[model samples]
Target: MKAGFSAFERYKMKGRFKWIAAAAAVILCVGLLFACKKDKGKEQEDISESTEAQAQAQASGEEGESEPARAEEEDPNKLEDGMMRSYLSGLPVDEKIGNRRPVAIMLNNLEAAQPMSGISKADVVYEYVVEGGITRLMGLFENYDDLDKIGSVRSCREYFVYTALEFDAIYMHFGQAAYAVDLLAQDYVDNLNGLGEAGDTCFYRTTDRQAPHNVYTSASGIEAGIKKLGYREDHYDGYKGKFKFCDLNEVVTNEGGGSAKHIEPDYKINKPWFDYNEKTGKYDRYQYGAPQIDELTGEQLSYDNIILQYNKWAQLDQKDYLAFDCHSGGIIQYCTKGMFTIGTWRRDVDSAKDGNVDMAPVRYYDMDGNEIEINNGKTFVCVIQDSALEDIVLE
Candidate 1:
C-alpha cells in the first residue's frame, strides 16, 4: 500500500510540471507581442517627426527653421544679372533641394519692376556653373505632393526659360498654354536684347488653342523623337498606356546598349512615396499609400522591375534636355542640361475675403520680396537654364 501511494504521488508531480510549462509558454508569447508593438510605435514616431520637419522648412522657406525669421523679410540684397537666388531670401543658391519658391533675385545687385520675359530681371549679375544636355519635357507635381503644388501656365513658362539655357534644342521642355506663350514672347525678346542670352528661349507654354500637339514643339513630334532615341512604348512604362519613358531600371540595367550613362543610380527614388530600403536592399512602390499590385502576377509591384520598364520607354541624348510640369513622369525623366523646378499658384484666398488686397490676382514676387502684379492671372520667366552649347534658336 505504501508503494502504491508513492506511484500516485509521482503522477501528481508530473501533472504539476505540465501546468508550469503551459504557463511559461503563454507568458513568452505575450512578451513577444508587446515587444513588437513597441518597435512599431517607434518607427511610426520617426516618420511623423521627419514629416513635420519638412513642413516647417517649406512654410518658413528655410532649411530646418532652426533659426528665427529674419527681422526684415524684405532686405535690399540683390543678385547680379544672369545669376539667381536659391530661395527668395531663405536658402543659399544651389543648396536648395526643390524649387521651394518661384521668386528669385534676377540681377546681381539691381532690382526689377517686373520679370523680363518672365526671367528674373536685375542689373547686377550672378553666375552659376552651367549644367548640360536635355532631351524631354514632363509636367509632374508628385514632388510637390506634400504641399499640393501643381504648377500653372506661369510656372511652366518659368520652366522654359531655365530649360532653354540648359539643352541643345529650341522646343523641348514646354507645356500647353497660350497665355504663357504670349508672356514668353515678351520676356524672351527683352532678355536677348539686354543680356545677349535668353536662357529659356527654346521652351514655351501654350493654351487650348495650341492643343492636340502645339506646345512642346508638337506632342506628336516629341513622341516620334522619343522613338528615334529607342523608346519601346509597349515594353517600356510597364505596358501602361501613355508614352512616358521614366523607367530608371531599364536605363541602368539595359545590358549597356545605348545612352544609359546619363541616368544615375537609384535616380527614380527621388519620386515621392517611393521608398528604398538599405537594410534589406529592396525597393517599395506604393500607390495611394498602399502597395500597388502587378496586374499579371497578383503581387505587390517591385520598384526594380517597374523602374526597368520606365527605362525602356525613356529618351536619351547628350545635347538635348527635358522639362516637366506637375505630373509624376513629368518630373522623373529629367534628361535635360538643367532643371527648372516650378510650383503652381491660384488665389489661395477669395478676393471678397482679401479686403481688396493690392496684390495681383496672381502676383509675381521677386527674391527680394517685391511684388509684380500679373493682372491676367499668369506670369512667366526662366527659373533655371543650362548653357551646354552656344547655338540658341530665337522665336
Candidate 2:
C-alpha cells in the first residue's frame, strides 16, 4: 500500500510541471506581439517626421529642392525699383506716381486767409516772405485729383517757380510778379495763370471774402487747365525724385546735429512756430497764438518734416517784390522726427532751346557731402533770406 501512494504522488508532480510550461509559452507569445506593434508605430512616426522636414525646406527655398519657393514672390506694395513711393509724401503710393506730375498751388497766407482750404491735403507746403513782411505758401500736392477747392490762390514769385520746377509740378497761380513773368513764359514752364483770359473758367469769386481773398480754384478747374494748356502730364523721362527718402523702419535724425525739439521760422507777420508732439510724431503748427486749422477739414494743419532753406535775395523792383538765389547753394535745416539737421542745398540749371534757364534736380547734402536722407512723410519748406536766418530759433 505505501509503494502505490509514492507512484501516485510522482504522477501529480509531472502533471503540474506540464501546466507551468504551457503558461510560460503563452506569456512569451504575448511579449513578441507587443514588441512588433511598438516597432511598427515607430516606423510610421519616422516617415511623418521626414515628410514634415521636406515641406519646411520647400517653403524656405532650400537648395536641392525641386518645389518653387513660396517666399520669393514679388510684393504688391513694392514697385519696380522703388517707384511706388510718392515724391511728395515719401510714403507708399499704389496710384500712378511718377506717371503724373504734382501740382504746386500758390496759396495766400495773410491773416484774412487764415483757415485756408485744401492745405491739409498738400503733400508739401512752402512758407516764405513775399512782401509787407508777410509770407506765402506753395502747396505741392500728389493726390489733389479729388479735392473740391485748393486755395485763395495767389501770384507766383520767381523763386517759388524754381521750387515748383524742382518737383516738376504744374505751377498754379492767380497772377505773377514781374520777375516771374519771363520765367513763366518759357516753353518748359507749364503754368495755369489765373489772371489770363481763361481765369473765368479756372477761378471763381465767393461773396464771403474780399476781392483778392475771394479768388479760389478747384481740382476740376486745375485738371481742365492742364488739358487746355496741353502740358505734359507724366513726369519727364530720366527724372529721379528730388529727395533721398528713408524707409519707414528707418529714423534718419542726423547724428551730431543740433536738437530741434522746438522750432521757430521768423516770419514777422504770422509768428509761426512748430512744436513736436510725441504721440502723433508730428510738429504741430501755431500762428498768431492760435492753432492753424485747415478750412476744408477743420483740423489743425500739421507736417512731418520742416526745412529752413536760407537763400540770398534782393528786391526785384521798387514794389518790394523779391528774387531768390534758387540755383546757388545755401544753408539748409532739415527737421524731422523731432530732430533738426544742418545741410546745404543746390540745383543745376539747364538752358532751354530758347536760351531760357530751366531747373534741373535739386539736391541736399550733409556736411560730409552725402545726400541728406529725409523721413517718409510730408514736408514744409521755409525759404528764409540769409538776412533773416539769424531770427530763426531752435530749442
In the order shown, the candidates' Cα RMSDs to the true structure are 29.0, 33.8
* Model 1 residue-pair collision total: 58
Best by lDDT: 2
Give the best candidate by TM-score: 2
Q: Give the TM-score of candidate 2.
A: 0.77
- lDDT tens string, model 1, 1-395? 00111211333445531211222232223222210000112233445776688768877877753755457634333444544332222212332222321211121101111111211111111122111321111221101112211111222333333322211112223232222344344322112111113223322344532322222222233333334433222211111111122211112222211221112222121211334434532344443335534222345432221111010011112432222221111101111111111112222123211222111122222122332111110011211221211111111
Give me the overall lDDT of model 1: 0.23
What's the count of clashing pairs in each model shown?
A: 58, 0
TM-score of each: 0.18, 0.77
- RMSD in Å for model 1: 29.0
How well does model 2 score by local distance difference test? Answer: 0.73
- CA RMSD (A), model 2: 33.8
Q: Which runs of model 2 end up more than 4 angstroms from their true locations?
A: 1-83, 348-357
The C-alpha lDDT values of all candidates are 0.23, 0.73
